[model samples]
Target: MGIEGLVAKGAGTRYVGGRRDWQKIRHRHSREIIVGGVLGPITRPDAVIAGQYDAGGNLIIVGRTGTLSPSQSAQLATLLSPAQAGHSWPDEISAYPWSGRDAARPLTKVEPNVVVEVAVDTATQGRQSRHLMRYLRIRPDLTPADVDQLQL
Candidate 1:
């Protein structure tokens, strides 16, 4: 017989809660993006934000890395330097079209010279990824231009 499953729910349930009410699970997808900058304080970064270059060569914000460990944060802090004047994507860090309360948080733009691979689950909306991404690792051998070769 074909596979089967059961979904238990309270009687008269009307979607009155969160994901706990759902019976289905979703899989995540992965991709590589250029590290455009880091968000939060330099001493302890909250997340690593990344982007991809479009056909027009514009560095478009793709997504931000998820919660990083202390060691990861410290290591990133050492590798990244504060973006100086005339930085590429000058307003990108502050002008990110964050939704809800996220817009209120500060973003520290860094040199967009690092490349990283990340695992993301959601679909892309406009130029941004729809979900928070997990940082898989840094691609020391890869350059920002290599992102175009990735299938996504």
Candidate 2:
């Protein structure tokens, strides 16, 4: 079977309406993506939106990182400059599902130079993460091109 393993519960424990007595731990996935943009104010960002290049050399929107720490936000501010004219993924940003129906805040696009490793639980439409990814760390050694070489 493709299943990695299984979890077991107590023999007499019956399914209750409240929280389950047993817990199942599933494998979580992680990937490295390029920092393409950010949501919320530029100085103190809410999340680190990221992307990766496909085989065709198109920068595909992958996902955004979870809420950043004050230090992390300040550090990112130093590395990320405002995207120049004719930024890539304009349409993608406008149509991004995570923005929600009543999104008022505009996304601040950053140069896709910074690379970060993030942990994701699920993916949507095989393109982006199903939810905001957990930010692991910034990768100074890796470039955006390195994302294509990754096995994931």
Evaluate residue 92 in candidate 2 and report its C-alpha lDDT on the 0 to 100 scale: 30
- Using lDDT as the measure, the top candidate is 2
Give Cα-based local distance difference scores for all models.
0.69, 0.73
Model 1 C-alpha lDDT per residue in residues 1-152, reported as the tens digit of each score: 22223456678775655567746433565677887777778778878878787766767677777788888888777767777776566443532443434344566777777787888765566767666788887787887777863223
Q: In every candidate, how many clashes are there?
A: 0, 0
Compute the lDDT of residue 41 as modeled in candidate 2: 68
